[model samples]
Target chain A: MEPELATPFRERAGRALDDRFLQEALTVATTKFITLRREAFAELPEGDALRDQARAIKEATLQRLDYWLERLIERIESRGGHVHYATSADEARRVVLDIARRTGARMAVKSKSMATEEIHLNDALQAAGVTPVETDLGEYIIQLAHERPSHIIAPAIHKTKGQVAELFARELGRETEPDPEVLTRIARAELRQKFLDADLGISGANFAVAETGTVVLVTNEGNGRMVTSLPRVHVAVMGVEKVIPSMTDLAVFLAILAKSATGQKLSVYTSLVNGPRRGGEPEGPEELHLVLLDNGRVRQIAGPLREALNCLRCGACLNVCPVYRQIGGHAYGYTYPGPIGILLTAMLNGPAAVKDLAHASSLCGACMDACPVRIDIPKMLIELRREVDQQGIAPWPERAVFGAFAWLLQRPRLYRLSARLGRLLQRPFVRGGRIRWLPGLFGEWTRTRDLPAVARRTFHERWAALEREARR
Target chain B: MTTKAEFFDRIRAEMARTPGRAPSALAARPVRPREGLDVLRRELSERWRENLDRFQHELERVGGVLHRVAEAGEVPDVVAQIAAERGMHRVVTWPRDTLGVDVAAPLVTRGFDAAVMPGTEVAAAERARLRGLAAAADLGVTGAEVAIAETGTLVVVSGAGRPRSTSLLPACHVAVFERDVLVESLVQMGLVLEAWHEGAEPSWRGAAINFITGPSRTADIELTLTRGVHGPKEVHAVFVERGLSVARRA
Candidate 1:
C-alpha cells in the first residue's frame, strides 16, 4: 500500500481543499482539458460512432482474450523476442530485475508508463542496483521531487512553474527562470545523455496487436522513440487487457484516443515495435522483452467490474469529473486518479481499499459521457459501494444508521407514529425550519450538513385533509 | 515466476465462468490486402490533386511547412533554403535510392556538412560514430513512406538505409515525397499497414515503424504548449509534382 493512505481520507481531502495553489491549478487545467476535448469531438462528424466501434472492438477482444494472448505470444517468440508472465506485482518486479541483472544494466531510461508506476518499479530498480530515469517532462519533474503524479496525462498539473524552478535548483543544482520552454530545454538536455548511456529502456504498451505481434506506444513527446530506438535492450510492461486483435482494430482506437486525451487529432509519435531489431538495421535494441502482467485483471473477467477492462487510459473522465476538478488527483491516494481511477483502484486492491473512495463521486455521469469507450464509471462505482456495504467494510455506526433508516422506510405505520412523537420531542431543537445540531450520536450527520425539519402536517395527513374538503 | 501454462489455465478458467456475453465482432479485414492496396493506389491517383490540397492544409495546421517542386531535382533547393534560413550547416539523411532524391551532394556543394547513411550494414564502431553524427547534426532529411491527408501524419518504416534517427535527433526534419505515397485517411493507412505485414517482410525492412504527425511537443508543465522537447523543432515536407525518378522498391 502507498504510504499516503496512512492519513485518513477526510484529512487528505481537507488538506487538498485548504491548499490555495492546488485549487487554482486544478480549476485551470481540468477546465481547459474539458473545453479542448469538446472542440475536438465537435470537428469530427463520426466521433460518436467511432467511440462505439472502439468499445465494441475492446469487448470482442476480451471475449476471446486467451486466444489473442496466445497468438501474441507466439508471434513475439517467432521474432526472437522473449515474453514473461507475471501473476502479481511482486512477480512482475522480479522478472524485470532478473532481466536487468542478466543484461548487466547499470542505468535504465523510462518513458511515461503508468504500468511501471502501478507496480512501484522505480524503488525495486533502485534496490537492484539499477538507476531508473524518467524521460517525460512532467514525469521528470515529479521524479526530481520524489512525488507521485497528480494527473494522468499531465503528470505535473498540480505544480506551478516557480515550484518547478525551485525543484531543479535544489535537486540538480541548476538555477533557471520559471518558464516552461526553458525548463523543457533543460530536461531535454539532461534526458538526452541518459538515453544514449542507459543500457535498458522501459516502457508501457498502449495496445499490443495479436495479429502482427506489434506493441504500440502513443506520446506527444519523442521520448518513446528514443527509448525504443537508442537502448541496447528494450523492456515493455503491459497489462494483459491492453491487447487487441489486429492492425485494423488499432486504427479504430488510434482515431479516438488522442482526440479524447489532449484534443489532438494524433499525438506527435505513435511507434509500433515488432520484437527486437532485425538484421541490417543501423540502430535498435538487440534484445526485446515483453512482460504481460495480470495484477488482478483476470478475476475481473467474471467479476462485476468487467466493463472497466475496456478502458483506454485516455483520462478524459478525469477532466470532466466534478470531484476530480475540485480536489485533484492526489486526494485519491492511489496510482490512478479520478472517476475510472476509483474502479481501477478497487480492481487492483479489493473493495475494502475503496470503502471511502467509492462515495467520492456525485453520480453526475459526466465521466460516462467524456469517456472515449464509455466505461459507465458511475454504474461500477455504485456497485462497488454495495459490495463495500455488504462486506462489512464500512464502519458499524454508519451501517447501523442506514439499517435503521431502511427499517423505518418499510414500516409506514410505525414511521408515521415515530414522526409525530419526534415532532413533539424536537421542540427544543427546532429553529428556523432547520435541524442545525443533534445532541447525541445523530449529531454526526448535521455537523457537516443541515437537515430539513419535518413538516407540521405530513404528506399523508395533507392528502387526507384535501379529500375531506372535496367530500364536503 | 508463473509459467505460461499456469497463466493460460487461469485465464481459461475465468473465461469459462462467464458463459454468455454480448454478441460482437471485430472489424472485417481485407481478404487480399496487397491487391486492395494496388486498387487504392489507382483510385488515389485520380484524386491526387484534391488530396494534396487537403494534406497541405492539415500539415500546416499541425505546424509543418510544405514546399512544392515541379521535379524531384528541385527538392534540394527547398532543403538548402530551409538550412540557409536557419543558418544550419550539419545535415544527415537517408540513402539516395531509398529517399528518391540526392540532396546530399547538392547540400555539400552549398557548403553544408552532409552525411548520407549507407545502404548496407557497417561495423559496430562505425555505427556508433554515425549515431554520434546524427545526435550532433542540426538538420535531418528523409522520405515519408506514407503521407495521410486526414491527420497530416507521415509513416516512416525503419530499414537498412532508412535509420530511424535521421528524422529524429535533429532540430529540423525535412521529408521529400511524391503523389504515389499519398493516402486519404487513417482507414486507408490501416489497409496499407495490413498489406505491408501480409507476407514475409522485405529483407531491408527493420522492426520499428513510426507515425509522426508534427514536431514533438509537450504541455505538461502548467499546461503551456512547448515544441521541440525531444524530437525536431521544425518539420518541412517537400512535394514533387512530376513524381520521383527512382524506381519504387517496396
Candidate 2:
C-alpha cells in the first residue's frame, strides 16, 4: 500500500530530512551506488555505444508498440500460455484476481516487481482473501513491516539490521541477533516453504521479447526462479513499453543494466521464461500468463514524457539525484521516486499530482548522465513544469510570483525601475549580504537556505557602464 | 476486462498521433544467426584458454569458485573433494546423458546418496517426490549450456534430464562444462540465443533459461551484501580441458 499522499511534498521531504537514520542510510547507499557505477562504466569500453543502441531500441519499439504487442500476444498464446490486457490499474487487479480465484490459489509468492507496486497489487490480493508474499528480501522486510518500499532495488535500505531483527522477532516469532547474515538465513528458511507451498507465482517483466515470447526477470536472489518454477500458475505483469524487438536487443540492454544499477557485470540471476513448462520437463508451472498493463503509459506515447517510457527502472537516476539523496524515496510520496519518479508520478497520476514534485529538481542534469539510456530527464521536467503552470494547477502564489517576474522581464524600462525599487525593497531584509528571511510566499525559499541579495549593480547596468567607459 | 483488440487499438491511436518521433532502428539482429554462431564458436574455440583465464578472474571476482580438470572423467573426483570439504553427503544431479558425465554411480560407490534426475517425463506425483529430493539435497551438480566469459556467467537451459532445481535449491551448486560451451561476450550469447530460437524448438526444451552469474546474493539489509539468501551459498564451475562426449545443443 502507498503511504499518505495528503502530506505535501515539502512537508514530506522535511520530515525525511529530520530522520537521522534515514539521512545516514541515504548518504551511504547513494554514495556507494554512485562510486560502483562509475567504476563499472570505466572498465567497459563499448558502454557508450551500447547505451545509445539501447535507447534507440526503446524508441523503435515504442514507434511500433502495437505491432510488437500483437506479436508478443500471438507468440505467448501459441506457446500454450495466456495473455491478459489491462487498460487500467483496476482492470489489471481484476485480471490477476480472476486468475487466482480460478486457479484456487490461496497464497501467491512474488519476485520484486515495480509494476505490481505501481498497481498496488498487494492490498488488492489481501482484500481478495489471497495472501501475497513478497519473496525479495528487501520487499519481504517492508511487507512484514507494513510499509512501502523506500528504494527501487534496495527496498529495505532505510531499515537497519536492528529493525529487521526486531521485525522478525515480532512477526516471524524468531528472536535473532542483529546480523544480516543470520537474518538472511532465517528469511531463507521461512520463505523457502512459501515458495514450495504457494499455488500462484507473480512477477514483473524486466524485458519481454516480442520476437520470442520470452519474459525476462533479473534478480539477485533466486526467488524469481523459485516463484516461476514451483507454482502451478505463473503471472507476469509488465508495462506495455517493456517489450523489445528480439534477443539481440535484450543483450544490448543487459550489457549495461547491471553496471548502471549495482555495478555488477550482471545480476546474480537472469531468468528467461518462454511460457509454461514444455513436455518432459520435470519442474515448472503448468500455466503461464503475461498481463500487459497500460495504466497511463499509452497517453505518454505521444505525450511530453514519451522518452521516459525508455526507463529500465534501474534506479541509477535516484542515486545521482541530489534531492533524492537528501530526502530519500518516501518523501516523494509515490511508488516511484527520484527525478525519474517525478516524471513517472506525473505520467501515472496526472500533471496536477506532480505540481510540487516537478520543482523538486535543480535541473543539474546528473540524472541525465547517470541514466542508462541517457533520457533527457531535466528537459522533460521543464516541459512538465510548463504544463503544470499552463494547466493552472500550480499554486496561485507561485504563479503570481513567476508570472509577475515574467511580465516585468519583458519591459526594459519596468525591469530597470523595479531593479532600482527592488534594492530599496530588499534593504530591510538584506543583512550581511544575504536575505536570511522573507515575508509571505517568498519566505518558504529562505526557511532553509539563505538567498543572496540582489547584486549591487545588475548585469545589465554593469554592461551599460562598461559601454559608457569605452566611449569615454 | 479490457480485450486485446481494444488494448492494441488504444496503443495504435497514441502511436498514430506521435508522427514526429525521431526515426530510429532497433539493434541489428544477426541475418543468419545459426551461421554466425557457428563461425563465432570456431573463433572462440581457438582462444578458449584466454577466455577461460578471463572467466576464472571474473568468476572469482564475483565470489564464485572455479576448478580446472584435465579430462571429463576427473570431474567426479573434484565434486567429491568439494563435498568432502563441506561435509556434505546428499547430492542431486542432472542425468548422465544431459551432463555428459556419470557422477551418480561414482558418488554411490564412494558411499554418497546421489540422486540422478530422470531423462524422461514422470508422473506428477513422482515429480513432486523428485522435487522433495532436490530440496533436501546438500549439493547440486549440473552441466552448463553456455559459459559466458565476459561476465563469468553460466547459462543453463532446463529440459527433460536437466531440472532447474538441481542448480538452484541446494546450498552449493557445481556446474561442469567443457571449452565448447565458452562464449567471449554477451554479444556472442545473443547470437547463440537467436540461433536457439531460429525455427521450431525441440520437444525437450523446457520453459525457463537461467543465467547464474554467482552465488545468490542480496545487499538489501542496510546495504550489507549477504550470500545465499534464497539459492546456493556457493557456486563452483569446473572447467574440463578435454571436452565432454555428450551431444551439445546448438
Off by over 4 Å in 1: A419-444, A447-472, B246-250
lDDT string, candidate 1, A217-268, tens digits: 9988899999999989999999999999998889989989999999998899
Supply DockQ values for each candidate.
0.81, 0.88
CAPRI grade, predicted model 2: high
Which residue pairs collide in model 2, if any? none
TM-scores of all models? 0.97, 0.99
The TM-score of predicted model 2 comes to 0.99
Candidate 1 iRMSD in angstroms? 0.9
Clashing pairs in 1: none
The superposed Cα distance between candidate 1 and the true structure at residue B9, in angstroms, equals: 0.5
Per-residue lDDT value at A246 in model 2: 98
lDDT of 2 by residue, B113-170 (tens): 9999998999999999999999999999999999999999999999899999999999
